[model samples]
Target: MSNDLIQVLQNLGRPQVLVLGDLILDRYIWGDAERVSQEAPVILLQADRSETRLGGAANVAQLLRGLEAGVSLAGVTGDDLDGRELRSELEALDVNCDAVLVDDTRPTTVKERFIGRAQHRHPHQMLRVDREQRTALDAQRSETLLQTVLPLIEKHQVVLISDYAKGVCTPEIVQQIITHARQVGVPVIVDPRPGEDYSLYHGATAVTPNRLETTRATGINVQSSDDAFAAGRQLCEELDLKNAFVTLDSDGIAVVQANGDAELLPTRRREVYDITGAGDMVLATIGVAMADGVSLADTARLANIAGGLEVEQIGVVPITRDQMLGDLLTGPRKTYQKVCDLDELAQHVSARRQLKQKIVLTNGCFDLLHVGHVHYLQQAADEGDCLIVAVNSDASIRRLDKAPDRPLFPQQERATMLAALDAVDYVLVFDEETPHALLDRLRPDLLVKGGTYRRDEIVGWELVESYGGDVKPLSVIPGVSTTQIVERLRGQTILKRPAVSQAHAPERKAG
Candidate 1:
């Protein structure tokens, strides 16, 4: 990555993200599932605890806050108890809720989900009751919402429209928001409702639709990756959107960009606990990352990791920066290896494998040791009995970096650093660019990297595939990087060195 990009990512903080659309409350009733009740055929839920959280557009705002983004929400809510609670929640998150209009004509939208759990079995959702209005917002109310939101639109870097098909996201409101956002040069993203016409989201920068929503809106049955790519592309073209992504549960996400590239981000293998607000987490992370100047590919990777983290916890929970940092630190660092002399590295790999121990092979250059690299190696160790990190030599670094003064640390120093990490079992230095030859010989059970690279982008992927081994990417820390630290140190030195020297000269003479 370029120094400028790294600097931008490290300083990602509180970029204004405007959220306008359907506002709702997500209430969860948790308990154990026992025998059926005498009065009905339904299983009895031994009530344990219940909680209420911001849902719909409100949940999106919470996600933005969790990612350390400054958020402002614009929508309509009922003038009732639920609306008050929703407002309080937004306030607690430090989100600007002044644009959330209160109307007495309808009740606040609430989805009450009753979950039943049992030991050694999967928790099942027994019932979900929703309170909402499907009708369009009144002309006066729509105008009122526009009046409140239009002025604030120019203040944000990115605008998100989270519609749940509630009256708040009328056709007129969506069109107005899109138009104003375009005029002001703010990127607008949408999490659209199912069965709703895509025309409502015309001119949006991007729209994230789940599998069912995509199928319903595009009239395309997505069964495979190709089908998903085709559907996503068709939808983007039809809607005139700059980008479109369809999130397939357990199958990862498919993205179609304006440049006509269909990219598939495979799902990270995980045991899901709860899927509540997973989509919200994805949308918020991607939107915030993009606003913070991360590339589209990086944004997608962050979203995938955020979604994976959300499903590990119960209820409508937000993934915090600390949690993301921890996750990135606890996994194995992934490497890209290009092989020039496969036979040479293969010989060394075979000799090591003959010892009868589980060989964990990971390849990457340890140019700058950071917390993210440490966590990735630790996570990779958990996948196998031992870990091996192959470092690229100085020549190979020049090939990959395309810079005369790159590889901040030499190969020997880099290998020694990797060896010092407790998660790493062994460290080897390779002169060539790719590690395919080495991987073929090592035949490791797992190949790991930081979560930024797509599966298809991994070098030696074919070798791992042939050997029945899996390749995984760990999450990247949001605001941590070696380049940023170096730049800061350099800037500080330039600012303070002359003053320090001048001040110390008199003291030295006195001594």
Candidate 2:
């Protein structure tokens, strides 16, 4: 039984994860806090930009998607603009929103935050306002949610409930989903509401409540890991949960199992930018790991890493596959703050273009980190304001006529290593033999490659040149490469062997 996280990550295929709870639309209004307002003591803000992202259960679904998991989100939303936008975004990601209901009584929940960005300091939340109907779900709506969730529970590998006390996650709905999931043997994980009765969430496989939440729910004043462990064990016992974890903000995650076993896993230190959806990140990570049959202790560790990465960003940012892999392999990699998929890359570059910044792109099989790779990346970074490196997947290396044992490092590790470098603003994996698909999507301001290949022979050079994008070929460091290192090792192994007769092996002496 190997406990290797990379092997687990490899085996944790795209399991269908069903996320049910309150769906919310989070809007961020970003601007500069230029001066003090005359009318009041509030700061004067020149709002320049605003954006909306999935929130609550929707945020969980998005986070699962970022971790490269198959997700389906179920909840209630009004037939309003925010509802429509939320559904459209989920559908665009191929998330199954079929079970989501359009209700008439409530407006779609929208949490709007006005944030102020200063020149030297980090962005701060100026104000937040929410619009929603907080009334309990009507019996008819409860029945609708139960019917929608029951059939899908068995279809998915695991079920996650993200309850924010919104009308959608009533007791009836939660119980029905839990009962059905128990019947089907699919584990149910719940992110419960603070100060509420955990009785409704009984029989869950696991419950993740934060420090303050544990204090409120169980009356446990948690100041240390020991207190958190006590709270977790008590909550698990009262609710009949198989496992319970209390998220201690900076200290770490303390988890307790029903068997009376407990452990506190400290989180990786990172810059706490904004903790908007950190719990969502933890819940989603647990859902993914649990569905793959990982141990609870390992699951908590991975969730801790995910939450740490979550707080390193300014908004409700999703922790990407590479970012987590980077955290697992090379500690914390801050450059992941800019890494994203092609669609997001397009949006990111367009915004950067609005800010009049140049975009540079380069693709390679950066296996086995060395000085050469770093310098090459640095040279590519010099070509533009933002550098995007596309890493070739291991399978892609095989298709490139390389040796069967090529790519000394896995694709995720390679991307993670690249993301740790200061020169790299973003890293994406391209599985094809060439990066033409990524090129077609990005159409970057500059295309860069190693000088080993002819200028005309470079892949995507013609397209880049045609679009007025410059193609740069940087000189690689001499006599240093992954192939050279591998070959040298192979030769050393052969030379170290005892000499044998060239014609044939001598007969063994009888003992």
Candidate 3:
């Protein structure tokens, strides 16, 4: 099932994604909690450093970009320094900033969280101060945002309405985006606000509401999947939503389709942390997956995994495609999380280039796990600090006429397994038969190829060398191949095969 879902991700094209809603800046102040003050009873904070990241709807754009989807963000930010800084941050991630408007009346929504650590241990959030407004965007500014966002809806395959209820997602603005998006036959996914009035988001393709918000919006006591489903159904019915989803905190997520079909994704077991942006991650994943034509249930599972990954982090961390796949195998790593879109790849490359890090890229159809793949991956890892392994999806493998019943495991599973290894820093799945386009996008410092291929014979070698990137070729395993494994398994009795450790040969190397 995981493999099947991963196949959907592999087949996902770089569809344009538009995010419309409030823009916020999240600030984290880290410090040490020492002795109390001499005059008053206040704990002294020995400040260390502070950092800022995108919040609210802007965060949805960041996650989409990390997932390799083309993203355009439309929202309103105050004309203060924070607002300008927020725009800079979005432009840094290569998000289209033209639609991000500015108003001088209100301040940019800033959620400043103070985290304190004592006695050199793990730090915890102590306090939070929000500096912003919750009132509706002024009439003129609202009209301006509508004018800016209406045209953007027709240009995108998917639209996300991230309602922080910070005034940007007014009824007028919501109606304009949703109405135009529907006219263009695009899916409009809404991350609804927490209130009884859901009419503001009416006509959206799907609505994602947490347990609390779902209960408030539908006036239902959501204690179980059945109750959540009831609430979701009510919301879907009221808002004419095609997909009704209720996110249950520890239990899981429940979805009620327009046809009344309901399914609950059981909570993937994990340690919970600050669920700051889990809902945002869920909404983004489902929106993009829905646009990509994935099944409703699989997209729910994908969203569930993304939410789980987000809570494990301290704050709003963008959920990337690689991180999403990596979480399916195990968990997420800081550096290996994002799989950049072509537009955003330049930004990541520029950042990496500034850091002077070595990049090694390799491509393969890693259908099933084997020792040879791991050994080659490790060899590839040795060539650079960051190793990017691009796997071919089941469809892509079939398109290449690689083998019958190829990719026993789905593309997601292959990418996840490879990313679970310590040697691999990132994994990308390409549906294209030839990775020449992907190579052109990345143009890594080193290109690694396995299975006895000469540097000159390898795909994209010339392109890599064009940018002074070298190509490294390695040997294949003595007697290891997916076909031999399948043949050996078929050759032996089904029950007997499980008892045997080696499928193809008497000896097998550890993967």
Candidate 4:
């Protein structure tokens, strides 16, 4: 099953997914709590940094992009700076926000969380304050939004409704969306709000509700698989839904279909740090998989894995396709398996950054794989949690004019040699003479170079420093060098072998 899913992921082409719901801006004020307030009993927080990210349905769009889906977000935000920033962020990720209407009457939904840490430990949320209006939109504004969003359903393969119980997800809009999408033969999935009256989401294809929401809607205590199945079955029957998905925190997801089929898809136990956006991640994964026409069981499995990966992180972090692929591997991976192409490495780097891991990158033409090169890479690895070694291609080395025939090995050989070392987490071959383009894409946390050049003279130093990344120079081993090794080999009487012709070369297996 794991292997099957891996094949599914490898061929999971980009599918257009339409998301409709409330848009929110999540703001975090990070600080340190070391002292008490002079006049009050609250801890005095010394703020250091502030960050803003997408929330609510906007977060679902971001997650869909991370999963390699073309996303279009349709919702409402206030005609304010926060709304503009939210739209800008989505656009940066290539999400279509043309349907993101603005209402000057209500403020954009903003959830401001104050986080504090003591003695340089892990940060925790101290308090959260919400700023917005919850009243339903006026008749005029609602009708205008419906007119804009109704036509977009035809352009998408699937429609996802993320209702945070905000003013945007009114009864009329939800029913119209479902009815219109059904008429066009498009599936509609809803992440319903926790309430006893779920009639707003009736006649939908599927509905995803957490345990609390299911328990409330079905009047059943969802503690075991049987309980969850009972609740899911009740929802599917009462709401006329084809399927009901109940998320059971650590146990997994319980799914019940209208045809009297029921099953509990168990999830691997993960260390729960923060489950801020697990539901959104699950919704995004389902939308992508269903768009690709994956089976419901397989889609549920993928969603479980995505949601599990989400909880291991601190806050609302997007899950990437590479992260899913890495988690789907059944056993330990070989060192050579770490060798990746440019696109795969970029995806892995994005996932690592979301997990708060530091990345270190270094580049060179490691032709012979000597101790000096190994020592430099080990030092670079010590600077960060993950070290990526970018090897120069054979054509690039020749362009550098190092010598008449400088590189003794091919790019594949050099990359395999580098991947065999414990210090390197990933090895990639670049055709560029300089690592500038690679640096721009990976954006490593630290850029390390091993040579006699000064810190400022290193390539990409300015580019690295521009993004708050550090640049350093490792100590060059004086007595050992690849040039010296080649000279010594030339002095020795070595026997040369004839090159094998293409027809006589061994047949290689398909990748």
**How does candidate 3 fare on TM-score?**
0.67
Candidate 4 TM-score, C-alpha based:
0.67
RMSD from true fold, candidate 2:
13.0
* Candidate ordering by lDDT (highest first): 4, 2, 3, 1
What is each predicted model's overall lDDT from 0 to 1?
0.76, 0.81, 0.79, 0.85
Q: Distance from true position, residue 391, model 2, in Å? A: 28
- In model 4, which runs have C-alpha deviations exceeding 4 angstroms? 330-511
Please provide, for model 2 over 193-219, each residue's C-alpha lDDT reduced to its tens digit, 9 standing for 90 to 100: 867588999999999999888899998
Tens digits of lDDT, candidate 3, 396-449: 777765547666888777777787788886678788777788888888999887
lDDT of 1 at 494: 34
Candidate 1 per-residue lDDT over residues 121-220, each given as its tens digit:
5677789999987687899989998999999989999999898888888888899889988998999999998884789899999999999888888888
The 10-residue segment with the lowest total lDDT in model 4: 502-511
Angstrom error of the Cα, residue 316, model 3: value is: 1.3
lDDT of 4 by residue, 1-511 (tens): 6646776777787989999999999999999987889999999889999999899999999999999899989999999999999999999999999889999999999999888998767788889999988899889988998999999999999999999988999999999999999999898999988789999999999998999988899899888999998888888899899988888988888878998799989888888978899999988988898888988888888899999999998779999987887786522447667788888788777666755789999888887888888888889989987899988888888777666776899999999989888888889998987888989999999998775556786778899999999999887676555665666678832223222222111100000
| Model 2 regions more than 4 Å off | 1-3, 332-511
Q: Compute each candidate's TM-score over C-alphas.
A: 0.67, 0.66, 0.67, 0.67
Error of 1 at 211 (Å): 2.0
Per-residue lDDT of 13 in model 1:
66
